[model samples]
Target: MAYVLVLNSGSSSVKFQLVDPAGEATDAPLVSGLVEQVGEPMGAVSVTVGGQEHREELEIPTHSFGLERAFAIMGEHNVGPTDVEVIAVGHRVVHGGKLFSEPQLIVDEIESMIEDLIPLAPLHNPANLDGIRVARAMLPDIPHVAVFDTAFFNHIPPAAALYAINSEVASQYDVRRYGFHGTSHEFVSQQVPKLLDKDPATVNQITLHLGNGASAAAIRHGRPIDTSMGLTPLAGLAMGTRCGDIDPGIIFHLVRQAGMSIDEIDNLLNKQSGVKGIAGVNDFRLLRQRIEEQDQDAWLAYNIYIHQLRRFIGSYMIALGRVDAITFTAGVGENDTEVRQDALYNLDMYGIHFDKEANLVRSKEPRMISTADSPVKVFVVPTNEELAIAQKSAAVAAQARAEGLY
Candidate 1:
C-alpha cells in the first residue's frame, strides 16, 4: 500500500491528491482536495475523503499556509502526514528545458536546476518550486520528485523543435519549442494504445488537451513527434484568455504604432485576449449559452476556436501520415460536447466519421465517439495527470530507496 502524494501548484492555487500507485483494487484516489486564492484576503480549502467532501474558509496568505491548512483538514480524516506513510511527493513542474527529459528526484541541485528554468516558465515554475520546497520541509523522510510538463515533448524531432532562426542565436538564447500539458498528453498517448488493443510501439495518436489552456500533440509510436505549444503555453490553440498563434508582427505594431509597453502587450495577449477578448468571457459553457442566445461575439469566438483546433488536427494527421486514434482530454475536451463536435465536423474525407449522438453523451469514463467502421477512432479520455504523476513519483522513489539514496 505505497502511497504517493501529487501536488499541482499554480500561481494562485494548489491541487493535491493521494493515491496508491499499484491501483490493483481501485483507481480512485484515497484523498484529494484543493486550496484556492492563496495570498489573497479570502482563501479556502476543500478536501474529499472516503467519498465525503469538506471545505473551510481561512487565511491562506502563502502557499505554505494553504498547504499547512490542507494538511490539517486531511488530518481530520486520519490521512495527514503524521498518520499516513507517504512514500513519495510528486510536484508538477511546468518546464524542464533541455536539461531534463524525465522525472527527477528533487534534491538541492535539482531544485537549483529547476530554478534556472524559471525564465522558461515564468508564471508556473516558481509556484511549482514553492510547493516542492514546502513539501520537502514538511516531510523530510520521503523522497520528492519533480515531474515536468515539458518532459514528454522533449523527444520531438529537431526539425519540429528548432525555430527557423539563426542557429547560433537560437542556441545561445535557448529558443526552441517546449510543449506544455505533457503529462496529460503522455497519459493519453499511453492509454490510447490500450483502448485500441494495439502495440504501444506501433500506435499513432493525436491528443487534444483543451481546458482554460489548450494544446495538441501528435504521438507516433508512443512518442511525441510534434506538439502545438511552443516555448510557452501561449503558443498553442486559442486558450481561455490567450491569443494563440498570433503573428509576431502584432507585438511590433503594438509597440511602434500603438505605443503599448512590453508588459502591457504581454498582459493584453495572455490575459485579455482569446475568447475573453472577443466575447468578454473565457468560460466555454457561458460562451455556448450566449451563442444559444444569438450573441454574435460569442459565435465569432466559438468559430475561431474551432477553426484553430481543426487546423492543428489536420496538420497533425498529415504529420503522423496515419492515425489510429484521436483522443480528447482536459476540462473542455472531456465535458464540452459542442467543442468536440465542431472540431471534428465534416472530417469524413479524412475517414473520420464522428458519431454526433455518441459525442453528446456525457460520462467520466473513456469512451468512443466515432463509428466503429470509421478509419480513425475518436475517444473522450479524461486526463488524470495526478495519477500519472503519482505513478512516476512512486517509481522514482522506489528506485531511489532501492539504491540506498532515500
Candidate 2:
C-alpha cells in the first residue's frame, strides 16, 4: 500500500503525518511527529506510534537538517523512508494570493507565484517556501502538491468582499479581502453534510475556528459567502498575540502624538497587544488561572476577548439567515468548556438553545450540544486539517499517475 506524507512546516517547527490510504482506516494518521525549535540551541523532537509518545532534545539549526534527522529516526523504528511507496507530498502553503484556486504540483511557475506573494504574507510564506525547496531537493522523484489557506474564500461575492473606498488603490495592489483558514473551513463545511446526512449543495451554516489564531466563515450551499478575516490575518477576531480589529487611525495617532516609531507600533500591535496587552501574558491557560484568582486585569482581558468574539458571532449569525447549524472546532472551541458556554449563553433569543449537560461533555467526535427543540443546532467538530491535506494529496497523486504526467 502507498502512503502519503503531509508536512505542515512553521517558522520554528514542523509537523509530519504518515497516512495509509488503502488500509481499513478512518482517515486518521497512522503515525505523527513534531520537531520544535528548529534553529535554536536547545531543540527537541517527538513522535507517537501505536498509542505511545516519545520526545528528545538536541541541537538543530534549520528545518532541512531537522527533517534529515527525523527521517533517520523513522528508519530506526522500522517506519523508514522506504517502508512505503511515497506517492506525493502535500504542503500547507499559508497564502496563495488568488493565484491557486486548487492544489497544484511544484514547478518553476508555481515557485514564482509563491515568491510574488511574499510581501502580502511576510511572516508565513517564506517558511512555507523554505520547506518546499528543501523537500524538492531531498525527494526529487516524488510529486509535491501545494494546498492553500485562501483558496476556499475565492468565491466570496464582490459586494461583501469589496471595500468602500479607494477602488484604484485596491485594484492595483490586490488590497481587497482574502480570507485565511480556508482548509479548516472547507474541512468542517464538508463534514457538516456528512454528519447531517444531507446533500452538501442544500445545506447552509456558519463555522467558527477558534484557536490561538481565530476566524469564522459563513457558508451558503457549500460556498463561502463571507468570512471574518479580511486582506490579512490581522483583520478578524483577536488572536493570541495579535490585536485584531483595531481602528485605522491608531497607527498615525501613535506616531504623531506619542512619538512612537513605526516598528514600535508594529511590535505593540502584533506582539504586545490582544489578551497579552491587557494582562501581560499571551497564553489563555494562564490567563484563565489569573482570572480565577481574582486578578482584575486578567478578568478585564478575558471579558474583552469574549466580547469581541461574541460580537462577531452575532453578526455572522445574522448574515447567514435560516442557519442549519453552527460549528465550533479547533483548539479553543473544542477544548475550552467555559469559553464555549459563555459565548453561547445569551443567544437563546436567536433560535439557539444551550444544553448545560451536553455542552459540558468533552469528546474527540462530532457532538451536538444544543437542545432537541432548538431551531439551530450547535456542534463541536474536531478539525482534521492534516487528514484533509492527505486526502486531497492522494486524489491528486492518483490523477497524475493515471494521466502519465508525473
Candidate 3:
C-alpha cells in the first residue's frame, strides 16, 4: 500500500509513522516507531506493527542509522520504508514563523526558510530540519511536505498575537503568539462540528489540547482568534514540564537574587517548573494517584493545572461570545475523567452543565460529556496528528504536481 511517512523529530528522539493518506481520520498507522537517545552511547528503539511491539537497546550513533535500523525492523513485518511505494513524506515542523501558514512542498527554499526560523523554536526547528533533510536524502524520488505546528494560528488578530513589549524588538526577533500543537488543534476542532451535526463554518468552539504539552485555542467560526500559547509553547497553560504562564518578575528574581544565568532560568522554566516540578512526576496518571493518596504537592499541582485551564476557558468563552462546544483532546484531556469533569464544573450560570457519568465513560471515539439541556456542549475528541499530517502532506504533494513545482 502507498503511504506517507510522517516524521516528528525531536532533539533526542525521532518518531515515525507510515500512514495511508486516503484513510479515515481515526485510522491507525500501518507502521510506527520511535528512536530515542540519538547520538547517545546507549539508545533505544521501539517499533509497533500489526499489534506487536519490538524493542531493543543499542548504540544508535545517528538519526540516519536509527531510522534505517527501524525500517529494517519494519521490513521483517512486511512494511519496510522501501518495501511499498511511498507516495510522499510528511514532516512536523514546530515553528513556521511568519513565512508559512499552510503545508509547503519541501523545496530547498522552503527548507531554508524553516532553518531561518530556528531561533524562534531553538529546541524544535533544528531537529525538524534534520528529519526533513535526512528523509529527503533517503527518499529523493518522492515529494516531501512540511506541516507546521504554528501554521493554524498564523491568522490570529495582531492584538491577540502580539505582546506589549517593544514593537521593534518583537518584530526583530519575530516574537509573538504562534500557538503550537496547531495540527492537533486544527484536526480536533474540525471534528467537533461533525459531532454537533453542524456546518464547520458556523461553529464557535474552544479546544483544549491537554497532554504532556497542553494549549487552549479559542476558535470562532472555524478560525482561531486567540490561543493559550503565546510566542513560545512555554507561554500557555501549565504543562507537564513547562511552567506555562508565570510572572516575568520571577525570571528577574531568579537572575538577581537566585544568581541564575539566562540559560539556567530558561532550563528552569522550560524543563523543571510544571506539574513535574511541583509533584516530582510529569505523568498525569502518576499525579492523579498522588492526589488520591493525599499528597499535598500533587494536589497543589493538580489545582494549578485546573485553575490555569479554567482561566483560559473563561477568557475564551468571552472572546468567542457565542460558544458552541468545548472539546477536551490530546492525552490528559481525552482519557482523564476528573480533569475533564473539573475543568467545566460549576458553570451553570454560563451555560455549561457537566455530566458526571458521561465524562467517566472512556472511549477512543469522540463522545459528548455535557448534558442535553446545556447551551454549551463538552466533548472528548481523540486527536490524530499523524493522520492529519498524512492528509495534509498528500494534498500539498498533489498541488505541487499540478503546479509542476516538483
Off by over 4 Å in 1: 24-26
* lDDT for each residue of candidate 1 in 47-129, tens digit (9 for 90 to 100): 99988988999878988888888899899889986778789999999999999999999999999999998988888899998
1-406 per-residue lDDT for model 3 (tens digits)? 7799999998888999999989887788898899999999899989999878999899998888888889889888889877887888999999999898999999999999999998898889999999889888888888999999999999999999999999999988888888989999999999999999999999999999999999999999899999998888999899999999999999999899989999999999999989999999999999989998999999999999999999999999999999999999999998889898888879989999988988889689889999988899999999999999999999988888798876
Model 3 residue 235 distance off true place after TM-score fit, in angstroms: 0.6
lDDT of each: 0.92, 0.84, 0.92
User: In terms of TM-score, which candidate is strongest?
Assistant: 3
Angstrom error at residue 279, model 3: 1.2
Each candidate structure's TM-score, on Cα atoms with residue i matched to residue i, is 0.97, 0.95, 0.98
Q: Report per-prediction Cα RMSD to one decimal.
A: 1.4, 1.9, 1.1
For TM-score, candidate 1 versus 2, the one ahead is 1
Write the candidate numbers in order of decreasing lDDT.
3, 1, 2
Model 2 Cα shift for residue 81 (angstroms): 2.7
